[model samples]
Target chain A: MELTRRDAVAALAAVGATGGVAVGVRRMQDREGGEDAATDGASAGDPSDRDTNEGTVRATMVAVAEVVYPGEVDGIDEFVDRFLDGRLDGSAHASGLREAVGELADASQAWHDAPVEELPAAEREELLRGIGADTADEDPDGTTAERVRYYVVNDLLLALYASPTGGELVGIENPQGHPGGAESYQRGPP
Target chain B: MSGAESVGDGRSGGDGTTGDDVDRTPVPNADVCVVGAGPAGALVADRLAADREVVVLDAGPRFDPDDRLARRERAIRPAYDRPDVWDVGGERDAHENAGEWFYPLNHARVKGIGGSTLHWQGMVMRLHEDDFNSGTVRGVGPDWPIDYADLRPYYAEAERELGVAGGSGVDNPHAPPREEPHPMPAFEPSYSDSLFAEACEELGIDIHSVPNARNSEPYDDRSPCVGYGTCQPVCPSGAKYDATVHVDRAEAAGATVIDRAPVQYLDHDADRVTAAVYATPDGGEHRQEADAFVVAAGGVETPRLLLLSESEAYPDGLANSSGAVGRFFMDHLFAGAGGTLDEPTRQNHVGFYTSACDEFYDDADEERAPFKLEFFNYAGPSPVEMALSGDDWGDPLLERLRDGYGNHVAMGGLVEQLPRADSRITLDDDRVDDRGNPVPRIEWTVDDRALSTIERANEVQVAILEELGAEVEWVAGPDATGPAYHHMGTTRMSDDPAEGVVDPDCRTHDLENCWIASSSVFPTSGAMNPTLTIAALALRVGDGVDAWL
Candidate 1:
């Protein structure tokens, strides 16, 4: 019953194919049942197949986010996808969020073809630190890896832990709160 | 201003009724009608619907937090500017023209079940007792007909309803005595909060944890906050307070919520509102008759609704016999000072705001100037806003954010705005909303009293920053500064009709059934967040309506 970001993206891709992107996006959302399927497919293959550049970036950003908030839940990938694909248009602050992810991915590939998990924690940390330092120096004008690092990590944290899946992780037994608490302290609806 | 009427789907209306409506459409109705699903309306309906029929109507559509997050890549985005096609008043000119400085003043409030509380920062504080009796104590602004004692019980009820989390220890001198402890523990403070608290202690000022409506524990069925940093967009965890929770409770209690029901005007008889007329999303007109009417449509929309409903009974507007439908508007004045701290005290804290000050809240000596310096809470703007406001990108931007994020502590002052007759909300001939209601024309100018208070507060902010070992900078503006969204005192409460619009009970003096449920009924703009007071007054108004029924 848990919804994942991958399911949302796949549904979004299907909607895009049907030429009802807006309607499809709204529909996919109306029914909250598609997350399991989306996340299932998401974990099976490399996200790079969808949009190579953006996918590579997203994966790299996810790796960087894992460094900031280790052992984050699964929804972080979907959050990055939504941001890069332009879901939060009215609110997004940075323009090259997706591109920064791609650069990090490219750097990771160039440095070592091994999956991020294969690398030792110290090596991974060093790689991210090096990338951040280099990006900070090179793109004095563009969104440095340092800046993007925080964005990616923060978004991932919010998606993995702040979303419903994350709520389950923290063992929030009441979901909204106890019924009496709902009536007494309830400010809004669930 | 130009008036051009465009019906839905680019059609023009020839006879006031659009051709789309000419095809007779069925009207929609609910049992207990809630005009707006904002904090006040939502809370009232949620509580009242336990026994009565209730229908909550909002002008906007319901939004899923997950979907919203997926759309806006960043967890927290600015109130203004977005990737979505939805016009959340995203256009910058609206905020700029309104003189909003801190955050976007006219950002889109979600039209769905939750209302604006979805994105609020959840800093809930009770207004000082002096705020209720400002006219008597300060001898400025119109006197409140009802005192704090009259509202204390309701405030307690509201606190319970909102599930406020704070330490209500007797040591706190400024707050009224609470009958019960907070529903949950206070949110853990950020490094900035601790730094501010230390600085306040050094200055011999008492600082404590700010009371928030955000759930610190699973009080209701909702989950606790997860420190998502998306409090401005939507709390995906449902930890932060929003009206949607109440709408759900209302629904469970047999209350219905109708989405996209935009009320246009009210049909009134001499002193009683007979019915409310609304235009649906499909360009259809619907009228709902009610025994009693509650106008919880916010300060801007409420007055605009009254002015739009001008009739023969009251030529100026509904309940405007006193000519005070949209007068005496007030918003808290905010200013910030930033400087380098002496120590590396920054840590990744869980929540945004932690410390507060009340030492200068009640200092009313004329020789010492009349304003209070309270701490302003923010984890700084989002990465994008910080980048935009500071030097464009690179190490400088990163260094600024990293260095300033926790080290910087801001103190904002909310001065009591003297109710001048000129600071009013009138109808704008040019700008019209989608429903053709005239956009409220705000003709406000800060009085000498407010300016003097601001000047004094600015000096105090600078002194405090210096004392805290911070290198300081102060930002100020003309009479109008900060966001107008914290709207107050348009339909003020008073003992006499000549001085204000609504009576002590928030009922319009001339209209028997018509009631105003917003910060508009405030006689003086106090130095605290208006959300708590707005909810308290709404609870009081709901009780009055229930009594009348």
Candidate 2:
């Protein structure tokens, strides 16, 4: 797109060449092809809300973690909570996790008639599975709902496999946390 | 030959001052001043300390296994990146700035007391007899001045000292005639090894257990391998044979190792090294005068150190009268191929790629560099790597993960790279390491001969995988080169000083009192890793310096 005088500041803001909310608005426009980001629409399950309820997001992650994380490792749910807490170290990706969880909680409330954390174990697993199924069937690039679900499942799996306790499930008393321990050894499907 | 009387032959005489500096700093004394405390230096120091005083200086920390183990337990993966476990600034920083693809191969090198062996997967494969005379037979790189026969006895001694476990002469077609058998029984091949063995048998290729420097049972007070799987980066148990093991033995024999002490330069007069100046960790300087010197730093750094030791008497760098220092840098091109099988064998998740096929080693075709075929088991983070494919999610993802998780295997090669004068390591004018030593600017990349060989190896691996009812997923060409941990050449060995830096005995031609005790003196890097060869050559170097004293 051509950088008009009006779009110049916005274009510069995208790269932090300029600063402030007005510059930020220009950055959003630059990303969205010079459109007003505030007026631009978001699809279902969008995490566009400026303020996220950290308490709800943290609670939902704790409860959902028990059902989604692999293996029946004792204290894994708490481990995941502590792990995610440590992951939120002031980066935008860290902040996006909280937002992603909030969007997911809202989506779960819409689909299963309750937020993910309030649901029982069996129901939570089913909800997460359904979200995963929905995520899998969508475009490989992923939708907002699929992305939210992807973040939830993958984060849980990463944290679980990273822990020493999760290492034992695959006979790796010391799992290379980022390795394909169980997946590489056990043939034909998890 | 007393340590005191054998003071440096430089202009300083017996007093402790260098001509460059006006300060008359008193110099410490040693019969032999060995540079770098890695495997080669430490092992050589063992023999040097028998009757003579020895001093080993290292640029890295002196952290013991306990220090590394604590870091390993704490950091998730890639624990070697931890500050206390690694030097944040050094040759690696230089490699990064130079922007080479092969950086990772040797970038994981450690500077601590143990050297890179601190984190190496302890495989100790011997060089083929034919590997000694590659230039004459295959017309690739220069032949080693010393052959396998000259080194066979030293190899056995090194293996016994390092606690090697393997099927001594059984099944291995290329196992050299040895004076002694392995110290312990060979580790049983993992299920994955069985699959490769079966396929290799049909292909008329021999697959045998690799000679590993790990205790199969307790020997040398070190425990046996507990199958930690995470042996790379850092071995949790003391089972892995590290250079520190020899360093400790050398220390017990009275070879003093001063860690965090980097040698800055050498003071020389005519043909003899007089004084060696070193920078301490605190940015202070110390001078050590010795009767003889052993430059046993790894390939890249050894040449860099020699180049950095330039003086008025030797402006082109010590022992560089032939202009061969920092030239012909070589590393093995790591090539391989693998995929998931149609059906899962019991082989999934086994420790170490135990079997190797060296039948193709010196197949001496006109185009391709001969290579040894190596296989790897799905023991490490295979499960995690497969799951993160980013293609599948939900039940489909789980189903995909389960289908091929344990059914995967790969066969690869430590393919050969011919030494070229153009692919050398030079000093960067601007960038300096923590000690202000000029960092090495490595110039290297893949060549056509290596590429052709890699392709052939890839084709063979794919055919083998298909024969085993596996679907091939990926294959990398041999063209991938550089920064191989098995670094050789640079200050390569030659009978004539006009053609190379060091003599066949590893003593530099220009300097009578200095010798290179590492693979940096290797004229050619064979398909096998350089560690075993370095150990053998280091033994010979010890004897060479002993005669000098």
Candidate 3:
């Protein structure tokens, strides 16, 4: 599917929040060469070349997105796929995210007898809260709950609010990295 | 000095030489060679290329204007993996810090064709009349060799050249006297600025339109600000003035601009500069001989260049007869207060500031230094920053953004820092750059007086935020504040040859033909943005070089 401005802004927001994801979003946006320019890591190579476990991380993140994202949000699977493409470079941040997703998968397997992606929406929410991710402070190197919150839950919210559609939901029609132009800023929110 | 008739003997005037006309043709000898393609050098070269054979050398690459949007996007990406968008860091830009506070030399400077203007916020202000006589009136710093009247005409000319947008004297009453209105109409205050204005009015403090080099309308063949809302690090639209505009003008005027050409040192004699020996990207060194030279390499590199040019005849350095080449360094320190209110301030909607308060600038006391207060339109955090930094998620996260995203306001102040002899830029022989030259070792000192000034400014800022019923989350003092990167006073101007490096005409006191056109020649730090003054002095240097030729 063609990358839209909304998708580009979401990709940039998600990359910033996750630290090492959505490297190909700028390239996809550049093929159109319109107003939007992603510019996260145009030099980064194939994301699969760096790490082998991006599948579990991407799957876990998608499952978490369904739990943490508001019900009004749509296209969960495609959005997660687009945001995760070229994000998993062989960086420490990418490894931490993978490890965090692994921890969540481990918890799901221990109690629900399946990976997080296989669990139903209600069970996924319960598993996240049962691991204390709903209450723990967001930290990359802290408890399993904190890592889950830091890498998965916050990343989804950031990608949402950073996108044009999500920003408009909270009166930020143009998020910080997008060029909504001078008129967007000159007037107050309608 | 020979007259203009005797200059440019072999070269044709305005031959349409451009920066792209770069080859290994070994730089042609010129009547004037300007080192550093920054605002100072660009203006000087543009002016002198009208009559003299001028050649400009810049250490950094001439960035493609079309790629600025991409650069801005790179800057907008996550701070952790964001590349050096401007290519500012590396062994070539490395330095050492030798003081209580680490001086962010490389972070603060851009060693490219447009220099720091490529990343500057474009706020332009003329120094107040009292700023010139600080020592005589306030007993704070040395009085400048020339006063406001001497630079008044040049300031007007620089404003016209840069296409400044400013409010009328009545709108900005505290500004220095001006003979002409700004070239363009002033930008209206941002929505956040209006919120601060109300609180400032209640506190009996007046805020006025800030003069900026960014275009208000289509001026100088450039588009007006599209507000890409990223003025600090990058202005995707060429709406904001950078030195490249003048560099292009200089090129069109037949001045040869050689980018990626870092001038190592000058080949000088007893009373004149003979040539500027520079390095190419391919690690090739060539000497561009000239009758006159202008060193406009900002504050840090200017002194670093001088100190690197030490020889037997002038063992201290080329222009260090007074032993003051790198002494008396100065920078403006910042103070700020930010908080959240119940109502929306609409912060971050506009990136550049449109209003400021200079009422406290000329009202310095014994304990408190002069300061200028700036109202930040991009206060607090962006929705993305707020989302990522917060601990909440799901519907609660959306609710939190609804409550927190727009209710932020902030005030920042630039407090005057008195020039201290100990706060200087020296060379560390132990460390070297990529070219195997000693790196600049900076010793920055924030004295108790400057700290007291910050405390006083913070009090004013806090009062304004409080007047607006803000929570007053933080107040910046010595511990939280840092330099504004307005580097000045390194090679201060003085009429006496023994007191300073440059004379009233900005010519080196020791070398008659060598001139400095950067903010390095400022005698005092006035808490005003220094680019306009730098442009004025550079124009004056252009005039002086024309007269010398």
Candidate 4:
């Protein structure tokens, strides 16, 4: 039961599985298939039932997050979900993740008609890059991409690889447990 | 004011009663009480919690890390302008010398759970060997009664607790040898860091990975750093080390942390600090009794607490017999010098600036004035902040932002400030906080040593920039004077009570049961960031208190 750094890493990997669940949930919601959406959903039209010409742009943000950083901890998905739900409140920056995801969805819809899964890796990367470039151009005033690139890239990587598993991925020891060997605090001269 | 009658001065006692009308509210008691959830008090409380009944009080409310990060993007919003909301420091009155814009010196000290470490940059550097025995070696500053060696083990413990990211192979002669490698690899150097490294190498100065408390890879349950520029604000991913991590650990071990309670003064019996009188946010007065008391209200409020606790036992202030409670204040004097590089130097890499030079760390060449100069490796100010400060502004700002969003590298110096008795913190007569306590009056003036150090650091920094074919712009002299949030060394620790406010164990000279935990107990304020050392010292003090209890 001793929690080594490796165990911590394993925990993080486990957390990432939740991202897949989030992606599935979003897909279902987009199809208007759930009872929860019937009363409070943004749209009432069923995309699958009609040729509505609305071109459903289903972005697998979880996959995108994973591609940005592979082999992240399991809890990452949970963290992201909580952040999107405004549950992980700390500072004002946490909301950026949700906002960024919304922008990514909007940008993805504008670029392609196919599901994110059907798009080639290059195409997906191009879509992301365009979004990033556009966001960078508009910066603080960016309507769809406001702080999305910074938040998505940073949060995904941090969730998956920034934890103990990430250290293992790079062959670095988790210094928190072994204080004497590697945890020397450094400061400037007095 | 004579008969303890209502002065109607708006300053109420703990019980929401004006004047000295002994409040009727039930007072809480503990074996030991500590004020402020910052590194100093938290470490002390963490150490004492095992054996003694400990209570820690903080003025700020609990911080939900998620909420904090979510709101961080609104930093420039009006909601961010509230006083005492964030730990950002600035004088109330706008002085002419105060820059045109309010240079936010956000100390990142949080109110709720972890204190300021919640938003810390996580750069954890140890004090150099010279830092401990500066007075003995150079005869310029007072020597710390406890040397670097005395705190080595604790530093190691602190590192473990913080989950620092660094390599053990790097030979830092001043730091104690480590048996294990870093928990995580050093963060990859940013493009600017690499350029600075090359420039330093060209200048014959050593550069290496800067040690940080952030998880490069995951250790513990925390995630790894993702190179987000939010290091100064809040880390939503929980990769950054914050005091809340320890607070959580301590709570798991059965420690109680009370938030939204600000200690007004120390309640004493004769020479001993018996309890702390505090005012709750709801305007209720409560007294908490304890066997021991620790004041970690930071340098400003710690001294302010002592001065306000004017009982008949020690009228000049508790533990102020040496008259050193608020004297010898020191902060790392920082200055930035920028130069355009010949090549891009990969200054846009996610995390590249990790190396540093100690050529001027302690050079007694007289020309250098025995100071340390650290090459800042972290990302500089945002493009907007930089545009405002840089030569480019307005239309030029837009052009520069387009041309060099990720193409500029600048090196800054975290210079040492010589400790002087005159650079002290007293009570501000005109100002009072929400708690009715006098605001900390910081009267500081840079001495020749600091000026000389800055001058020499600028010279070397400019030289390195020039050697790298960079166009250099140095900000020094009167124009460069600005307060760094890394404040330290007001109530220093020493063996002799006459020379310092606290003993080697951080015990106050006058109050047997009172202790201090903060950088305020540092005798010598090293040139580097003090958080790591402060945490380490707190761990050491925690160990001491554990034994004592």
Name the top DockQ candidate: 3
- Report, for every candidate in turn, its global Cα lDDT versus the true structure: 0.56, 0.65, 0.78, 0.57
Q: After superposition, how far is residue B482 of candidate 4 from its true place, in Å?
A: 2.2
Kindly list the per-residue Cα lDDT of model 1 for residues B371-490, writing each as its tens digit.
Answer: 445554442333323432421233344455445543444666666666666676777777667666666676665666666777777776777777788766544533444542577787
Candidate 2: segments with Cα more than 4 A from true spot: A1-68, A71-190, B1-27, B70-92, B96-108, B345-351, B379-381, B384-404, B479-483
- Model 2 / residue A88 / CA error / Å: 18
Which residue pairs does candidate 3 place in steric collision? A21-A87
Candidate 4 regions off by >4 Å? A1-190, B1-29, B75-109, B169-183, B345-353, B364-370, B376-401, B474-478
Candidate 2 lDDT tens digits, B343-455: 54444343455777777886854477878778786422344334433544434444554554545677767788788887788888887765667788777655678778878
Model 1 per-residue lDDT at A41? 22
What fraction of native interface contacts does model 3 preserve? Answer: 0.36
lDDT of 3 at B63: 70
The DockQ value obtained for model 2 is 0.04
Highest TM-score scorer: 3
Cand. 3 TM to true fold: 0.81
Candidate 3: tens digits of C-alpha lDDT, residues A1-190:
2224456445543343332344555456568664333232322453432232445667888999888776677777777666655344333445556667788889999999999999999899899989988777666568898877766676566556656677676776666655565566556646
Query: What would the per-residue lDDT of candidate 3 be over residues B395-501, giving only the tens digit for each residue?
Result: 77778877777888889989888888888988997999888889899998877778888998998999999998899998888789999988898898999999999
The i-RMS of candidate 2 is 16.6
Off by over 4 Å in 3: A1-70, A75-163, A183-190, B1-25, B81-83, B387-404
What TM-score did chain B of candidate 2 earn? 0.88
Per-candidate total of colliding backbone pairs: 45, 19, 1, 78
* Cα lDDT tens digits for candidate 4, B1-549: 000011111223322322334232433557667788876667667666666677888765564332343233223121233222343334321112122312232342454457667656677877776778877676677888887788877777777878888756464443445656666777655445555666677667766667877887778988776443345555546777878777766656656777667777888867688778877656788888877777877766688789888778778777898989888877777766775554433322122236565556665432334545555533333332222223222234334544554334566667777778887777766677766667666766566776777777777777777776776654554357565666677888888888899999888888888888888998877677888788887877776666665
Tell me the spans in candidate 1 whose CA falls farther than 4 Å from its real position: A1-190, B1-31, B71-87, B90-105, B108-112, B188-190, B347-351, B365-406, B475-481
- Candidate 3 Cα lDDT to native: 0.78
